[model samples]
Target: MYVAVKGGERAIENAHDWLAEERRGPADIPELSVDQIKSQMTLAVNRVMAEGSLYDPDLAALAIKQARGDLIEAIFLIRAYRTTLPRIGHSRPVETDKMACDRRISATFKDAPGGQVLGPTFDYTHRLLDFKLAADGEVPEAATAAPLQGDMPRITEFLNRDGLIQTETPSDEPPRDMTRQPMEYPAGRPLRLQALTRGDEGFVLGMAYSTQRGYGRNHPFVGELRIGKVSVEMDIPELGFAVEIGEITLTECETVNQFHGSKTQPPQFTRGYGLVFGQTERKAISMALVDRALRWEELGEDNLGAPAQDEEFVLSHADNIQATGFLEHIKLPHYVDFQSELELVRKIRSEAQANTLKEAAE
Candidate 1:
């Protein structure tokens, strides 16, 4: 390792200046505003928020812009900024049953209580690009519908009524935040969920795919997936009560899995849950599959030695920021490490040559 940075101070400053110049691009082209990224490039902003463990779309958009659309770098920026913020208070658990749903669907039931609002989605849309969008003319407005009059019952609640699925009792205890403390092995469901929610979407998706491919088979079906806005509330000591602060978009997924019954309990369909910061259905689904895989021990199912079933391995490597750090560090000066390797190689070669000479004489 070098005593300082391999690049001198002037070279580093010059490189940063060059980077800024490159980030700006052509002088003729207009610079992208943060609002454009927030509103138009919405999915990218959502991903940054979800993976970065921060709920600010505007900030995520800014980070995206600053990082020149490199999502992982944007996440790193957000995480660094998040660590500097003061810990005032934590929000109460959001109630998904009461969400103002934008998109809602159920795979288990054709007609749920909510009646399957398609909302704005890519599911039914043809992949063919529309040239009209490039022309920048006024787009046709979407049709509006009246909001549901009453509370739309959750799909799982229906199965729960008949005791067809395992029951998850609500607890008054607060969920442990993984950020507050070091991650300990054999982490609880709360910690695992926290990690999965903020974990890299690709890594989680791969693990989920492995499970589906029979690596750690747990027959999984999407019971319901919903995307919507939920109110965030926090209690203030001075106010003496919880007050609604703001609303944030969220995606929730519940998977119904194969029945796991034991001598003490009757056969019941199992449950796997996923909740993320935004409308990231893929990540939510992947999180649920991996979540189910981790529940093998709790469900009395044998571990199949799959990566998904191994909580420590999955959780530890799922963070892209951490993975990138280890990967990129090798690009730095490795003179000390390389010099030792070079010396060992030289010594081995010299010894081999001496042996060869002695053999020739014999």
Candidate 2:
């Protein structure tokens, strides 16, 4: 992975120096702190954490500061840092149904079980910029309400009761860990979900959007989309039981698709799931759509020959870090490669002229 340049050390060092200066900006204005970024620029931090496959807000904020607000660069830094940390033990699967939901909405149903909680959404707001922030950073306090009460059962469960949607077949086999092992295809749904959750948001969103635009159409309705904090539990060897390690905010999405009938099974609704870290509703919803699209074969649905349906294509290119790394390598000095190409072109041109002159003489 190391590319050595003969006399580029001083140039590289100077570039680093200039980068640091640019990151700090003007000396007159007060410098921003990691804490301020951690607290204030919450969505950006969450995105870094999600894409970086790390959950530390402080680290994400620090990376953002170091990258000068370039989120992809921040993600690259976080991913590199994560490689140095030692692995402990795997945590139990998060139960999102028990989540302390900050926002929950369903497009398919009029009112879901727990009712619609529109917590802190920009859905109804006008897109025009609120110039009040340019003058001063003050705002009115938000109204508070009592905690949401009731069992947060999944909307798919209702369809499942009527045998309208496919039921999940329980498995004792441990799902593959893509982070621990090298990615191999054809990957199962579990492995694909792993990649999708940590995949680049923009790419996944675009792929999902393409599906809506008639490529591998899945007539998906938002069964439910909820964002909130859920407790993370880990099984302790010493304690011989699982303990609540901490709480993590997450976004879970479920999409309901049109009914389909096959040779063995009757016509039933299909469901798509997306469970991701932080309150990334857009990514979560996109993930659900793509996840369903990828399940064409498993669901006994016909392959519509769409990009989203191709697991290898989607999973391989979804990582922004890998993509950026490969693309950025071209920026490095390629003098020798260029010189070889230049010589080849010159030789080809010279041979062509010689042949043309010989033909003219004849």
Candidate 3:
């Protein structure tokens, strides 16, 4: 009798205990509280907020701690948690032009109107590891200047003034919510951008790098990169007017890429855009590049058969939750399918051996 292994329950319990021990590390060491992760691991928390499509850094940090620093698992936790959150209401469209920017830069111009402010970036830092940080050392606060007032002008607006870039008028129409709906083929710009913002950073980076490596290469220049907070206003039906609900940090990148003119058209610049839910410059920039590459068809440019250029390819595979869930599910037992394959292989081999013996006898 072929008996299946027993004690599955006990095995699972022991495995869980081991996992919990591993997650907490040595008992002598101080336990990591969720608040500590939220404040100390700000960058990691920001990434979770961006990719999980939620703005709660606290929740993201908790998810991270719970997941034992497995970022995809953290994202999954946030996504699942977000699904249960009650829908209060939709907010008014955020005006990026009126953003209170902390970091704003443009690669297209040497000196833009507002001037570049490279705030709180690790870009200039050497890659050397700091031994002091091993003991959780604190950095001294730098001198701060008073907040700049008045609205910051968009870099794209300047190009539009000169008739250099394609001019786009603002629409009063409401944009579709991608999370609430299943994505269909031939998605609009809003839908595409939403997918890219919450996309896996590595996948986005690879796609962007592919474009630079001659696959759908469209000479790109960073038109603008801005990190700032914008008010999320919600309309109160009883009050009859929209009021400030809350605010969220965002990173917006706009890329100006070369656009070829058709026989009857004049050459003009087209745009690739990205907007993420935190200060993530690299992800935002990569997202813009991939966005531009995917716009080849819309801008009347040739499709160079790049992975990034394929809208369906990029949007469909970008999310971490979808990718990880499908991948890790394979670890679950599929003995029935394996048994079928096992029987088929044995039968085929046996039949081949028998045919060989028959030929030898003849």
Please tell me which predicted candidate would have the highest TM-score against the true structure: 2
* lDDT digits (tens) for residues 12-44 of candidate 1: 899999998888899899999999999999999
lDDT of each: 0.89, 0.89, 0.86
Candidate 2 global Cα RMSD: 2.8
Q: Which portions of model 1 miss their true places by more than 4 Å?
A: 1-6, 146-150, 171-173, 263-265
User: Who is ahead in TM-score, 2 or 3?
Assistant: 2
TM-score (C-alpha) between model 3 and the true structure: 0.94
lDDT of 3 at 292: 84
Per-residue CA lDDT of model 2 for 1-362, tens digit only, reads: 23446776788899899999999999998999999999989889989999999999999999999999999999999999999999899899888778788888899888787788888777899999989999887899989665454558887788888888888786788998887899999999999999999899999999999988888857899999988888899999999999999989998999998856766557888888898878788899999999999988876777889999999999999989989999999998897897788889999999999999999999
lDDT tens digits by residue: candidate 3, 1-362: 23334457889999999999999999899999999998878888989999998899889999999899999899999999999999988888788888888888899987988788887788789989998889879878977554334688788888888788886655577767899989988997778988999999999999999998888766889999999888899999999999997889888999998766755445888788888888888899999999888877766677778888999999999998899989998977766777787889999999999999999999
- Per lDDT, the best of the predicted structures is 1
